[model samples]
Target: MTTRRNFLKGVGASGIAFCSCGMLDAARAQGAAPRSTPVMVKGKRIKTVDVHAHCLFHESLNLLGTEEAAKVLPPTKGVPEHFIVIEQRLKEMDAMGIDMEILSINPFWYNRERDLAAQIVKVNNEKLAELCAANPSRFGAFASLTLQVPDLAVQQLEDAVKKQGLRGAAIGASVMGQDFSDPKFHPVWAKAEELGAVLFIHPQSTPQLAQRFKGNGWLSNTIGNPLDTTIALQHLIFEGTLDRFPKLKVIAAHGGGFLPSYAARGDHACFVSPQNCNAEIQLKKKPSEYLNQLYFDAMVFTPEGLRHLAAQVGASQLMLGTDHPIPWEQHPVDHVFATDTLSDEQMAAILGGNAARLFGLKEV
Candidate 1:
């Protein structure tokens, strides 16, 4: 079987630039030495899965051609000897005690024309399937969808999961400026529900908040990403999308944004000012109660934060996640282990059990 290391070696030979030279160069500038192979923890090996991991769609970029690819992808100053070197990725995974990573590429073609978006989705899903096939032991993927065209998206989801063997669909919190709560997206949600596919909601930069997030702090990604997720989840809750698709398996990145943290406020708002909420959309449960039906990743970066998320949503709804390749949460397993709030069973679930069950993996 072709392993992740072998597949990435092929990717490197094909000249696909997965990591930007600037990022690697910056690491070298900091005098970072080559990472050594990681030591396994004593006793039984815990199967840890990282639900939030990313990679470039090299095949899709090639299909887009030079100019369009440049428009879609970030520019790099120099060609590094390797990009997403599989051996290196494995070493890091070992170091962090992550047994597997579910890869995804947040579609950047949402604003493109329907035909262009479809093409991008096709190539992306195909490439993702190929990668997962090459390394079934260590990798799985969420399919790309063209949410702008809901009908096409529904069909694409079916093809990716049924034919290509992807686990689910990875979607931005919103398509272009359109929120997922829009009625037109109900078809896509229904399809996902029917397929029992996990819908991973990873937010894009909130362009609407660009003005407030400007200058020095990288707030476009820092504050803007999580803020966008918060808004998206709120819309799903308040606008009745969640109520409509009650069985939808949605996984919210960054600990379900800020909603899980301040969910009581939503309940209070609904109680104090019924007139403020949509009277037409009556929910069966309180807004906060709906949180139990949703899932979150342990990427909050603090023990207290993860504990709060677990307390609100329950550990059963929380899973392991590291926004890998971006250098966040480098010690995800250790982070979960260090959190005092979780019991041994809760820690086991967050580390890998929940993810294994959700993704239908039998390895654990």
Candidate 2:
């Protein structure tokens, strides 16, 4: 049972704190007490794995030049620097009881020139591989791709996984303003399917919604981020990309966004307006049928939210994900453990079992 007190303890007051003021104040109030670690289950230590962790690539920043990188990245204090120190990261992981984290850099160079994008991809992949190599047991990585140039993206994926030992690739929900469902991205999808790479779809705040999201609250991240992911997943489902690449191991960040909560609407839409639904791209299954084919992270931040996600997508398809280096869900393993809805087996699987199989982790 996840009581409100337990939830607040695991995530701090920041768990329920939505606005910037609340977050900032909560950080100051919480002080520097270490978080409680994951508990032992059945006399065994649960091997916790976080599939949605992020890292900064300083080399890429240097390549892009400070001015260019600053434009794309958020103007946060000590971001890339905070994530770069290996000792600091390991200490935090140990405190949180996370045995491993699959690192990824959300695509920020998607709109850059082909050559610049390729170079950024190369540098990011190399740095990530190096980090994983240094901390083989504690860290794994997803390669960054130049999706604006699909052919280059495909080649980069192959090289990254085969040669670099990267687990998969991390991509944004969209390329510039273009959705993943666009035919131009087919080659990249096909290559990912063939390689059996885990394509992690993370969102960069949806630019189209900037005007609407601007205000005192961080609606851009609170609403815009998940909204972007929702749009991307819908396109993939309705536009036949999932049907085309059924075997692609795709993981949607932020608990598959709003899709899981309102998936039945897709089925209703198809049935109600068959003419609006493309017959050429007619899905062999209902739009919601694809939910089971995809995977989601347990970053919803509440027991009820996580329970709803599990019901929609099943426990087997849900993995522990903490948008790390960010203060969201500080104690991720504990958050999953706090959920009373999941059985001990289901809990174990979400914490690490599923990720071990998906990423081919030998340690588990």
Candidate 3:
């Protein structure tokens, strides 16, 4: 009963529908296809590892109230305000193309009051352990400690590592106005070395310097933090701490705090004249040798800087770092990618490979 034109129209519609279905089927087949993954930059391939990233909890402040937190460091509201949750951090990591992030919290590194410090340590470490528990592959923790109590610090280090499966311990550059190299910390260092732990030394605003530079506006982080690190590193190197514990993995955050750039002076001073340097430790090799042995994060904020870091310390020693949730959200991997000199292999090493080896992560 239908006209020839109607029949032709129906046929045409059916053909169009058939083609749509066929296209979808083709797409589904393609989507299901397994292809070789090539980590290429401009047609070259490489792997990457992000060794330094910070993850904090909103509940931390609740554990340490405003007054208590301020007494410890600087007070900030903690209850409802989560700085950056692990889930969001993981999502951000995906967007940033970071293969892995070595996580630590440097906020409560040095608090003299034993009880408060211990409490904060418990809260942070438990959170870190839980986070790592929830996502084993995606997270590794650097356990917090109450460094004011060296014995307690050692205890926490053992518990955090053996019990909680932590990778290392994060300590402040200076603990209670005293450098970490002081003999008081020998037990802590000995334990760390015994465990083959990587001690991540982060800088905090010195209280004395805070009072001195109150009006100059350079007190908080600008000059204070780097200065703290520089002094801490010098003490560690010159005071014979590194010599005492040769196997200890002491990771100086912030590009070794001007040590790499100014290493020649120390070497020249140590070699050219003995008394010029006051370090008690007798040195066999040049100071630069120790520098080479120590690992540095690529948070220099530029490709040129990263290239120089690689040149100073071989690409194998360079690790990716993104001090995220800070004012600068720079991704160190991106800087490495922008660099023209690094081959794919070198890039891979700097990005994530070296860190994997350092943290004992299985091959990704």
Candidate 4:
């Protein structure tokens, strides 16, 4: 019954400040928004496990073995060249103090053409496998899925994980305007939960809202992305997707897009009207209990927000996510260490310990 507009009203200016003040200060201090060199963490330096870094591949050089495939992809943001190699990525990771990066392509580049999307996922997975083969310890992959075809997605997921040895899967907040919580996606969620796989849900800018802000270009990526995440989470919670697939290990990016801050309102609304939802799953606990079950990334970009997210989700469920290749957000490790509220152990967990546990990353 609660609309998206009313939900966003709760996460106003204070919420934005809570999530982004520290990085804003760092950028403001620099005069120009400059990238900071990754600092060495004192005491026992946490092995940084960045869950949201990205990469581009030579689609021409892919198994498809045609230059046209590369041409289909719109140009990536950070890496301008046609081919972004693994070693160059390593240098950037080193600069950012990221010991390991979970690589996946941004979903915006996806063409809804199902066959092409399938080919793209195959090529991307191959590229990732090649990288991990070269530098096994330094990288893990969040395999792309051709969600346009759920059965194909399941097949690719099996290949990516069982055959290619990738860590898990990465998905967009929505597929073709349909939310992940839609009944059509039950098979996808069931497969992911069955594998005990980590599903890293990333936000792509909303397609529908793009026309609304045609002149103000910033609205799509800046506002629409978080909005997309917020909408997706709302659908998952209110529609009872989380209740049905309780075992799904969902890792929501952008600190769950202000979901923790708005937990009270969501639970209250759900309590007042149960028939509004689709799935019949009920819980003795509040909606906050469901949030605690879901994992979040430490890309919220401020000490206060990080403290709040840690308090909300618990340190064990918080992993590092750098919106890498997107220069706007703060670097993951720096943001985690900057938080005074997190003790040494908590900081370590956010940086890498939690990720290690989640992905079963062997400690170095």
Indicate which candidate wins on TM-score. 2
Q: Which digits, one per residue and each the tens of the lDDT, describe model 3 over residues 21-118?
A: 11234434644211112233333333445556665654665567767655443333231213556665665565455645667788564643777778
Residue range with the least summed lDDT across 10 consecutive positions in model 2: 14-23
lDDT (10s digit) by residue, model 2, range 217-333? 798888988989999999999998899898989999999888999999988996788878777877879889899989999999988898899999999898988777676777676
Alpha-carbon shift of residue 54 in model 2 (angstroms): 1.1
Model 1 segments beyond 4 Å from truth?
1-44, 63-68, 71-83
Clash totals for all models, in order?
0, 0, 5, 0
Q: What are the models' TM-scores?
A: 0.85, 0.89, 0.80, 0.82
Let me know the TM-score candidate 1 reaches against the reference structure.
Answer: 0.85
Give lDDT per model, in order: 0.78, 0.81, 0.67, 0.72
Q: Scored by Cα lDDT, where does model 4 land?
A: 0.72
| CA RMSD, predictions in order | 7.8, 4.7, 12.7, 8.7
Q: For residue 77, what is the lDDT in candidate 4?
A: 51
Per-residue lDDT value at 94 in model 3: 56
lDDT string, candidate 4, 1-364, tens digits: 1122331243242231112222446555754222222322333445678888776676623534456545545444555522556666666666566778888776633445777677778888898898888888888888889887888889888888899999889899998688887787888888888888899888887888888756755777667777888888878876678888888988888888868877778767755786775455665467677888888888777778988888887988898887666554545555665676777777767778888888998744
lDDT score of residue 299 within candidate 3: 74
Error of 4 at 321 (Å): 1.5
